[model samples]
Target: MSKIADNIESTPHSDLAKGDEHSVKTGRILVAIATYNEIENLPILVERLVDTLPEADLLVIDDGSPDGTGQWCEEHAKMNVRMHCLHRKGKPGLGSAIIAAMQYAIDNNYDVMVNLDADLSHPPEKIPELLEAWRLADSDSTVAIGSRYIHGGGISGWPLKRHFMSRAINMYTRWLLWLPMADCSGSFRAYPVNLLRKIDFDSFLSYGYSFFEEVLYHLKEQGASFVEVPFQFVERQYGSSKINMRKAIVAVWTIFRLGLKAWNPF
Candidate 1:
């Protein structure tokens, strides 16, 4: 178990000095979302999250987008103490951004953490259910994934090729890495700070889109349990996708490399 997880598991949510959990009726939570030119979506997403998880704080990890996303994050943080923003020097890969967010959560002593896209495809309303899952489980190692492949879960406003590719990615990772997850490529996830801290970011492998699956595989190896919550996944309304055909191809190659390395670690 991570030291942070150990601290939270032994300590009750009522004891946190930062924000009280009773308002949200959940633990001392931190919601993390990575951004790169998400100005159009970030504001509405942040507002909805504030209302949904009243007690939980939201962290925006901005990659210094040309858009004023980082500036908005700073200004918004002034008004709402619950909002925190981290501005990177440049646009790093998705994996690095997520790792940074997880690090911040661990450093700040939050009891639970949820990571979703800035695009609002992962509804903030489903947050309660994720926290509920953690509450029911006896271990702080429980991770809840907002899955689209699970029963009662699916996507909307996605092209057939995109949908098919998503399914194929899951199948590929599930078979190669032996992952039990149905939505290996999905970014909507909830994790305990302790469990996330246990991951070694120093030697972290993979980049770009493959980062999500790489994380799931490592977490499973560490004995962390998972819960899949079905939800409607929607396409982004604003901003073009950062992923390109070249990155997609590289992600596949990286996955195979990661799988082999894990299976036969030297």
Candidate 2:
């Protein structure tokens, strides 16, 4: 984490507090992306993010991708002012990547922090819409999820079995946890940085795909308010998905364990 801290200090922050705004605006977004061996998709993702939301800063936490993702980010940082990347030692799970990114955002006093994919599956253009929804909902809305299960929201390029499996998982989670949000598995979402700090990140148990489910369940238990925004879920254009059967098994076990924990916090 010292490397991350040092990187933050090295970046120029003179313009961060300019234009008569002591507190940041809703548009002052921090996009946090977790990556592992995503070198092919990263540059394109960064470009789209910069073009779609020029004011937002991007933090890329790479889990020591052997494919030179860290080096690529370093090279890009020289020319891109709004981009920062953190290189962890090994392939830490998605939850750890997000936690690290959230810590960075909270430490730097960002107004809103977003989690998105590097595979361009999550459209950068919809980012403003998520922020707007959160703003309209006011400070009480702790999270804004980019949902695929709601009306006008659906997945693309998935086989019948895959789609069915995803929906089944979400249904099981909702039944067991009673989470109000529709798409607990979806990772693309925005959160108020301050509210994020309220949740005990250290107590978060899951480190894989199930982390999304556990976090949402915990937030709901904590009385955190949230809203769902419909998003078109596109299939990845590059690189294979990291999800596997072992991860799926772990997700089921994690849900059972964490569900009980959420129900009985004592």
Candidate 3:
């Protein structure tokens, strides 16, 4: 079972404007982070987010981290009015944690939901750039992406092998899934909550890191548009990476499967 420790009260969906149309420019925004043993990096991330985006609310979905990451979130939520924490049992998949945040955003009637990693690799200061791009987007279905492959954006502190692996995976996903964006695998993305509501969470096949790419595929199926915002992706300053060879293999296989299904949905 999951538990919530939140400072903000639940706002009714009826409070939203009628006709199901919502504008991100005027609607509430949520910044969500999915974490597992991210306590070492999370505090600094929280501080940066609070300082950088004072108007946006924050949500942390922790998967029962052994390092007391969930506990820290609970304690911090009490002091921060805009922060909320969802504590899930055991170490569930990364995708599930993000799905929970998506549900929370929907339930709370947020118009825009921005998701980022808790490891500080995705810069908190870049969030406003994504939001600004969202505000200026030509369509409401736009998913503003913080892309590292785009011009004016790059990666820092990664070895040649790691860089090659990342670029290869992105290339593979885009070619197979027909994803137009350059950085489809990165977690730094701003999603329109209204578009998220159109997707059926129970139908999703990805429960791991593949969720990042799979989500874009599904969003595109729902007529979602793309807007790439360049941002430098810095390697985490603290804590080891959660991804391993096993996870990467699974993600690749899953993307291949998704591609086949995309070509012929039986």
Candidate 4:
């Protein structure tokens, strides 16, 4: 057993089901989904994920969704032993939600925390592919990203303007931050808990979409390796997008500021 698991074995949550018992390949896994009024998509996403990776524990980090998303999570967690939820006040932003998830993984002694959008844009079935990639990663400090820009990967639904904006931000991240990953803005990623604990999440500057890129920059600073796993991305079929023009502007500005901290600020 891993050191994390050994620690868990001595805690109150020791009785919690161990993913390693079911799948020796993947250690204790925590699948984290950040939700903000995601009731329309969350239920189906949770079911699909539970079915896809029954071994891994599921955590829904909700930002006080008035649509009863947190209520649903509480109800479901009571019935599903492997399911859990974190309730936050108001809509703080995706960055804070993910940071909470990371802290939870570290506190609970999880080996890996696989984070994805709750909108169902990221396929639940591809989670295993991420875990496999992490397993095969050359370094222990590794993060596996489900990349739509990689070979054999493409988006199912997205406007031309959306595509342009995404590509521009990605190019900016690569050029400024020196990150080589093709999909820096994507949310589907698997982070090892050991590596996540090394960084201080409280000092994050971006609390919105830009957190995606900012995190990669910090991880690279901590000597974390990254691997891109190709996966098809589907646009959300339900509910309106939470992103706004303000958030996009903030992302650009935040990346520029972070870029200045880098040696090659171009």
Cα lDDT computed for each candidate against the true fold: 0.81, 0.79, 0.85, 0.85
Cα deviation at 35, candidate 3, in Å, is 1.0
Please write out the lDDT profile of model 4 over residues 129-238, one tens digit for every residue.
99999999889899999999989989989999999999998998999999979999999999999999898776667878999999999999999999999999999998
Q: Residue 247, candidate 3: how far off, in angstroms?
A: 0.5
Extract clashing residue pairs from model 1.
Answer: none
Task: Give TM per candidate.
Answer: 0.90, 0.90, 0.91, 0.91
Candidate 4's C-alpha runs over 4 A off are 1-24, 264-266
lDDT of 3: 0.85
Worst 10 residues of 1 by lDDT: 3-12
Q: What is the lDDT of residue 88 in candidate 4?
A: 74
Give the 10-residue window scoring lowest on summed lDDT in candidate 3: 1-10
Error of 3 at 262 (Å): 1.0
**How far does residue 83 in candidate 2 sit from its true spot (Å)?**
0.8
Per-residue accuracy of model 2 over 1-266 as CA lDDT, tens digit each: 32223322233334432212333345457898888888999998898898988778878888778888878987997776677777776666887777777778777778788999888889988988888888888555469899998898989999999898898989888877878878989999998876776777767778778988888876776667888999999999898899998999899889988878757769
